[model samples]
Target chain A: MRNLIDVTDLSVAEIDELIATAEDMIAEPDKYAQVCRGKQLATLFFEPSTRTRLSFESAMLSLGGSVLGFSEANSSSTAKGETVGDTVHTVSCYVDIVAMRHPKEGAPYAAAQYSEVPIINAGDGGHNHPTQTLTDLLTIHREKGRLDNLTVGFCGDLKFGRTVHSLVNALSRQKGINFVFISPEELKMPAYIKENTLDKNGLSYEETASLEEAMPKLDILYMTRVQKERFFNEADYIRLKDTYVLDPEKLETAKKDLCILHPLPRVNEISIAVDSDPRACYWKQVKNGKFIRMALIMKLLELQL
Target chain B: MKIDSIQDGVVLDHIKAGKSMDIYKYLHLDKLDCSVAIIKNVRSGRLGKKDIIKIDSPMEVDLDVLGYIDPDITVNIIRNGVRVEKKHLALPEKLVNVIHCKNPRCITTAESQLPAIFLLSDAQKRSYRCAYCEAEKTRRV
Candidate 1:
């Protein structure tokens, strides 16, 4: 049941293979158009997501595969209170693969227990989202030309960001990867991630609250929104909210090739002024998501052009 | 409960239902030369169902290990065809560094200096969670 419940489910070698396929898909789209003819993809999103649902539909459509799914729990049998395992078991009968998103953590993993087809976790509530992790990896590989020997800085709400945790888990498997965690004291990275993923792997990393101080030393800066709710008090939020925002002023100390990345729907975390900068790669990440998903669909279906 | 037909043996009473094997293995009863009888699913007044392990000969048992695994267990020392002494056990409420938390979000995961402490969350379900993060302890089926 080769399900991607977590980013760690795929090895570094497997990720490289997926990346190679994604590159091939990017270079030549027509050659792989009819690879999944007559295949049906079920995008079982228990939570509503415009970009992610569209990404999966677009990827399946690109591969000549049709898509079927409900956009929210209201439209599905789950509205009547069906269990995730039962819904997935029934969906497996009609679809070749399953991509699920839920509001509860570990919902996809629970679905995988009964699903007969391959299960892909689109996103879960503050939990593993391997596809987004794959998108970040594909973008990083394409932008930097290597996954190793680079310093990556993750800024903002590290405690609740599933994307940061997934990326850190994946990157820790690579060689010579140094991590710089930049965030306010309240939003600092969780100890479990630090102990289990980084230190347990014998990886080197340092923590800082100043994104500007870590800017010049970084090869990649992955930015995440720090919601005001993550802070304990208004005083602390006012004191620290602006420190992580990437702006033209912050770029003065950064390297010319410093690739700035952000998981989308930015709310002033990266100033509007920095979008025009040559280093902004968050939009590129959105595009790479489709290609990487295309590669993942083919890899999971075991289809070839 | 009394092993009326036997002489000079030890009796373990009021073990949680189906936990006799844990006690059996903990005491290394498999390699013992004496006859060992493990009674399972025995009816009890306090507990609806329980298990009992009886050693056919007098032997020294580690009460600390037994108490930690199940506090409800009581050991009856039998010698010369008579019950000599009964030892009751009391386990501390918090277990420290005895087991690790399975939760990925637990504080003990990163703070290597902090001890992994777990508290019994559900006695009937036999479930425990980390004291810091309060993640439910998962058991191997």
Candidate 2:
């Protein structure tokens, strides 16, 4: 009966259950491979995102379910000027569940408002991507063996990183967790998040520009890309972005067990040299993305559809 | 300091002076059958200026129109010449089947028959983003 539009939509217990279900799926993959057999996942992505779009498909396929819908706005009735509500209502008839990504904020919520089937917000502009938060959660649970008591560092772009905002909103709820916000001034976490979520929760976090200084004490380093488009001035982007790259040299200062996580298609926020360090969990994060989505698809559709 | 009371009516008070006409146009209050007392340039110790509109019959107040006119205005429901309830009008939870998305190219904005639906994201912020275009709208009347 509920839609997964934001990470806040899933309670702490539900998140734990989702991570636990993902763990079980990982251990016994074949058992859950066909749980969603014959069901279809309609992915209405108004924006082009190969990684996210494919992850949903991979998740559904791994669940023995079929995938339907479009990747781009041009390919869909959106090009013909069909309304999002109409599109979702129409697609809901053909699919048991829906995942929609749009360039506009709240578009998925609008779709969810009318969808007869369960709706998953793949990504809605800069608003949220709850599934990515699920991936981060599963990764944290797998790597750290628990979601609590970890000092997680979010480096690089935080200002406009929906994944960063979603992850922070998700993790700030857990007990004994602390945060190190590593970003340049221009890309610092938005005030709304700091004021609304972190400060309101009374979570312990410090904002800093230096990653190396914060690296040693962290249990998880969640790196997000420093987007060029986010900057109004090219000089600002140039000056601030290069300050937080995580190379092998920087990894030596990090904890031996530090889990490096990124919602991927990363653009050099973490150097390629750090990829083989066994601590790099971004690719593992991607795989976890698929399984977590599989868990979500099963969880959402099983109850309602 | 005397005020007339009406049975089964509404009393809109503390509106900004000179805004009565705007509120009237916004709410389309002219179309209704009830006797309406629209007091303009009224004295107010609190606001330094004010206006009031009294209706002699109960009418459904258009909150969207109210939201557009001035978010600060208050409404009072009167029954049997006694004040029953004083309600502060607010934007509805989800404005569906009303308004039109302004973005001409947006799918929902283009669909003439479909109501322009907008979900109120931040209430205190007094901002309504178009559900289709992701455009932010500020109420000014």
Best by DockQ: 2
Give the Cα-based TM-score of candidate 2 against the true structure: 0.82
Instruction: Enumerate residue pairs that collide in model 2.
Output: none
For candidate 2, write residues B34-88 as lDDT tens digits. 6888888888998888999888877888776676457678899989889889878
Q: Please give the DockQ score of every candidate, comma-separated.
A: 0.06, 0.25
Error of 2 at A303 (Å): 6.4
lDDT of 1 by residue, A201-280 (tens): 78999999888789999999999976564344789768766667778998999999998898776888999999899899
TM-scores for all predictions: 0.72, 0.82
Question: TM-score per model for chain B alone?
Answer: 0.64, 0.83
Candidate 1's iRMSD: 11.0
The best candidate by lDDT is 1
The superposed Cα distance between candidate 2 and the true structure at residue A1, in angstroms, equals 3.3
lDDT of 2 by residue, A161-199 (tens): 879988999998999889899988878887767865887
How big is the positional error of residue B70 in model 1, measured in Å on the Cα after superposition?
8.3
